[model samples]
Target: MRRLPMSLLRVLWVATAMFASGSALAASCAWPDWDHFRQNTVSADGRVIDASTPEQVTVSEGQAYALFFALVANDRATFDRLLNWTQNNLAQGDLTQHLPAWHWGRREAKPGDTTPSWGVLDSNPASDADIWIAYTLLEAGRLWHERSYTALGTVLARSIVAKETAMLPGLGRTVLPGPVGFHPQDDAWRLNPSYVPLQVMHHLASALPEQPEWKAMLDSSAKLVTGTAPHGYSPDWVIYRSGKGFGPDEATKAESAYNAIRVYLWAGMLAADAPGRAAALDAFRPLADFVAAHGFPPERVDTQTGTPGSNAGNAGFSVAVAPYLAALGRSDLAQAQVQRSRSLATQSPLGYYSQVLVLFGLGYLDGLYRFDADGAVVPAWTSTCPAPR
Candidate 1:
């Protein structure tokens, strides 16, 4: 009789083992399915990261956006590899240095004179990087449930704002490399209007509403860029000392126009009062109408006639229009525009800009359908763009 009880125990143990094995097997098979999903939606062929092209330093800004896409897509393997590669290869990838200068293509920093000064990195430590890194780290923390990642995001965001305010005339004393006698208006300290990380602040405000600074930053930024300034009414212009400023040219304006639409959308949703919401929408109308009338803006505008300064395709710039159009109750327009933009993006040789367009297009398209209404975009979808084919 005692032996019979032991036999029953053994049978139960075996059954439990079999169940566990089967469950593990199911999980093991999940990758190919995920790859299949990515292939059909994100990538035409789902095996590589970034369409298997090398990252270009001069165009590192696009690369950073792609990194975020990878993180959001829940491709942990690729994400980890990218992080490792960035750390080893890029100057800003050095997470240990909270304020490293963002180097463009090559992983290592090099001595040189470049015009962009902030093509990828503005002011040594740029607001664009701050905003992007903050959101990326925040998303990473949420996905993995790790406090460290969130902490990194929080610190980076705080640092970004601090850096910006410090650079305000007599406030910020720090200076970066460039030519001697180079003025603040020069490449070294020249404020890249497009580099203002207002969207990050917008996102942070919602994520941590308790922090009043986030909202304050957003309000102040809106005023500074679009609000009545001492110089004149500007729409997100680059501010310099001596009260000199340059409005977003065609290229910068195109980027800002799309960004502005998104920021307003976010602000309207998070607004505590009708006046605040109304103001945001009112501010967006002119910008939206301008874009609708003219195609996605040219790279640089003459700043006088709002005419294209150079005859060039906006490259990845057009991808942003899709989501904004969709948000404004123009779904059909958004889809058509996305298709046009994606077709243009695909024509690029290296697939760097084109892949980003594909990802953004997918996200915008998926988002429009998910929300079905602008007011409900938040809970409707989070940004997990399909991988590039």
Candidate 2:
């Protein structure tokens, strides 16, 4: 465990004291970006809302990211608030017992109902969100010295191993995107590269040595990233058959877009000694090169032909690749992308997805936090600075 600095201790108090008023977080200097997100995207009740949708949907992905960001900010009050709301509303009041539903928001009442209701819009749970939430809880527990958080995280991780994974014909155990609907045929199982972050897998293995499944997944997840991105560009979705191995998913036409973007982000933030770091960096070099040649990233790429589409990516895409470029020692390009991202943000307000990407990309570039060799979170706020010269 690390000691919190006096400056950050003040920020924590500000965060907790303003729990009812929801005002002080905006004024904290620990992380200005986090302050903006806490004020804008997260609701007073702790739900992270994608305000663009008609239903104003609340995805488990958003909630999970918020938990992580709060932890990085050393704002335990917000983290617990977010966790409590997720358990009570999305997980049927017991996150350890049930995987939180991936989708929740305003819902129109069924036939004979008096008015539209707000509840679980979809019962299916997203595995990415589950993994992130479990990881966040485990880290929070260790950092805060809270046994309850650790116990809950352990159960959630075990539940994930039990319910969200499947044994492939030759690949051993691999994580599915969700519990259902991914296996469309007898031989085929659909998977998302973004869903299996190797860094996260590494931490899980170290943290839960008893769960051998986490250890095996390190290779399987690495294969998913390298195998699917045959042209050095990851696809949003891919399929693995009993004998055929990895193939493009027709459902998504094998496009590399929003979902695939995350994978590069995950790989970029990997610790130098983390498993599969070298291969992951090499496999996705083409995307980074494209950004280097051009000023921005491609909005879409044909994963098969290595051909980038005509449209350029949004501000989020540019910023999201900052870590990737920095990882490759392209400091010049990294700074350029971050500058472009900020300029774009000034032109127009960023939406939820762009907002989160900026947080992840900019946060890492700014030294707010990093993942260690053991896959544990190393937030900047946890440690004090050196004595002034």
Best by TM-score: 2
Please, what is the whole-model Cα lDDT of each candidate in the order they appear? 0.44, 0.88
Question: Could you estimate the TM-score for every candidate?
Answer: 0.59, 0.91
Residues 1-389, candidate 1, lDDT per residue (tens digit)? 34568889997887675444222112111223234324532322222234343433433244355446555344545555545544443444565455434544323334784532312333254455445656676766764556777776777566655554433343233221121222444332333333433444456666766555666655545444343222211233333443443333333442333233224334323323322444444544543465576665333433334344444335445554565556566676566666667577567542444445445445545531122121112211133333333
Q: What TM-score does candidate 1 get on C-alpha atoms?
A: 0.59
Compared with the true structure, the alpha-carbon lDDT of candidate 1 equals 0.44
Mind giving the per-residue lDDT tens digits that candidate 2 earns over 1-389? 99999999997887786653323323222678888999999988899999999999999999999999998887878998899999999999999899999999999768998887899999999999999999999998887677888899999999999999999988889999999899999999999999988888889888998889998877788889888888899999999999889998898889999999999899899998886789999998998889989999999999988999999999999989889889988999999999999999999999999999999998888887899978898877566422211
Clashing pairs in 1: 42-387, 43-389, 44-389, 57-104, 57-105, 89-107, 90-107, 166-172, 250-301, 251-299
Clashes of 2: 0
The clash tally of candidate 1 reads 10
For each of the candidates, give the backbone clash count.
Answer: 10, 0
Off by over 4 Å in 2: 1-29, 109-115, 385-389
